[model samples]
Target: MDKIKISNLEVFCNHGVFKEENVLGQKFLVSAILYLDTREAGLTDNLEKSIHYGEICKYIENFMKKHTFKLIETAAEKISMNLLLNWDNLEQIDLEIKKPWAPIGIPIENVAVEISRKWHTAYIACGSNIGDKKKHLDDSIYALNQRETCRITKVSDFILTQPYGDVVQDDFLNGCLELKTILNPKELLTCLHEIENAEHRERIVKWGPRTLDLDIIFYDDLILADDDLIIPHIEMHKRDFVLKPLAQIIPYKRNPVNHKMVIEMLYDLQK
Candidate 1:
């Protein structure tokens, strides 16, 4: 993680709640700390090896001027997302949008909204036991990639596996995918649930059969447990259907909780 800083680049933009402010644009100061690996650029002494700060400055100015939003918060968020998506080498961004000409009666210097945004890698397990299993899995992958915020980076070969729970059901088509997304853990979970619902998934029993099942097995080496969802998926290590496919794509990925790689977990389950 290396840093490239841009300070107090001023721009005139029409972003405010008041109508007058929108009609007559105001001055705003933009700043950013871009996170990326600059080693190659430094060693090679080539501008192509790293993001060009001059080009980035131009992009930020153009973005700020072209969009009209009511809040600096919105401006900051949109800018961060655009910068990250547009720059392949950019890993993270710390952005700040300062509004100096506020309508507030107080003598405050300025108001600003600052935020940090980045891409996150997540592992998702997909299972389908009913109605055109392979088709269901393929469709789910397509749906996930349809979103601009999410991309399916890698996929494991779908394997036929026996049902996990006591409920007698047909063999399931199970697999795993590596997802690169800007969504947070909860947001990503919501996206998964939406995809499941679209595939007519029902949760009538504890381990009931379903048209589609999408679970978040891992989120960026994160350990999380909430009332609704858990990261590293509570029982992922014990299930071969999950570990087997996961191992195919990211065998060396370690569980943040147990510190076991995917291959080791699968070996343990088989043992």
Candidate 2:
């Protein structure tokens, strides 16, 4: 959407590889583009409805002076995360960290790192078939809500469903959750795995039975594939347990691979 740009603002901070660089400090120029919806603030002329650029500059200045890091990369990472966490209305950040003074002998203009970071919308499928199935599912949602990088936006009511794979086990309580997350796909997967292990989940017979099963149904519009994880879950549209809940919240979300919306998939499954 809309953006507020903060051009090259100079600040002196101690961030370098050399020992003296940390002691003496150097000049750094930072530029940031803050993304947000300005319609509310614009219409009302309300300061509270918008992010204050003046205050943000002051925050940046203070943070630069307070922390001493060996590399600008580290500083940029922390700053971006902090901005996203602190500014509720901000949707994304485009940041550039420029270092004018360099040890290299060549006369170069500047060395800098530019990066883009944003909160991604993710949908997760959670199920449990073993002991305390509902409890396990609820606990996993609680755990995800506690993380700073993850915010649980919505959760579907648990539904009883038969076990997907061939195994002599009890029916599962399945549900879906929508989240706004700053964590990357891999990082989010790791967090899910951690929650599963905490609930004593097991993977003996390939989705046969478990205390908790968490799967990534969707992450933004991303189409990702790896040995350990896959995005836009490969078979989610084909499973009623998955579509029933997912369609509740994101009925219009389209599958990047198949070019079909959740509503279309749900209708197709029922026929």
Top candidate by lDDT: 1
- TM-score for each prediction? 0.94, 0.98
What is the lDDT of every predicted structure here? Answer: 0.93, 0.92
Q: How many clashes would you count in candidate 2?
A: 0
Q: Pick by TM-score: which candidate is best? A: 2
Query: Residue 216, candidate 2: how far off, in angstroms?
Result: 0.5
Error of 2 at 33 (Å): 0.4
Query: After superposing candidate 1, which stretches have Cα over 4 Å from the reference?
Result: none
Report the lDDT of model 1 for residue 178.
97
The residue ranges of model 2 lying beyond 4 angstroms of the native Cα positions read: none
Cα deviation of 7 in candidate 2 (Å)?
1.0
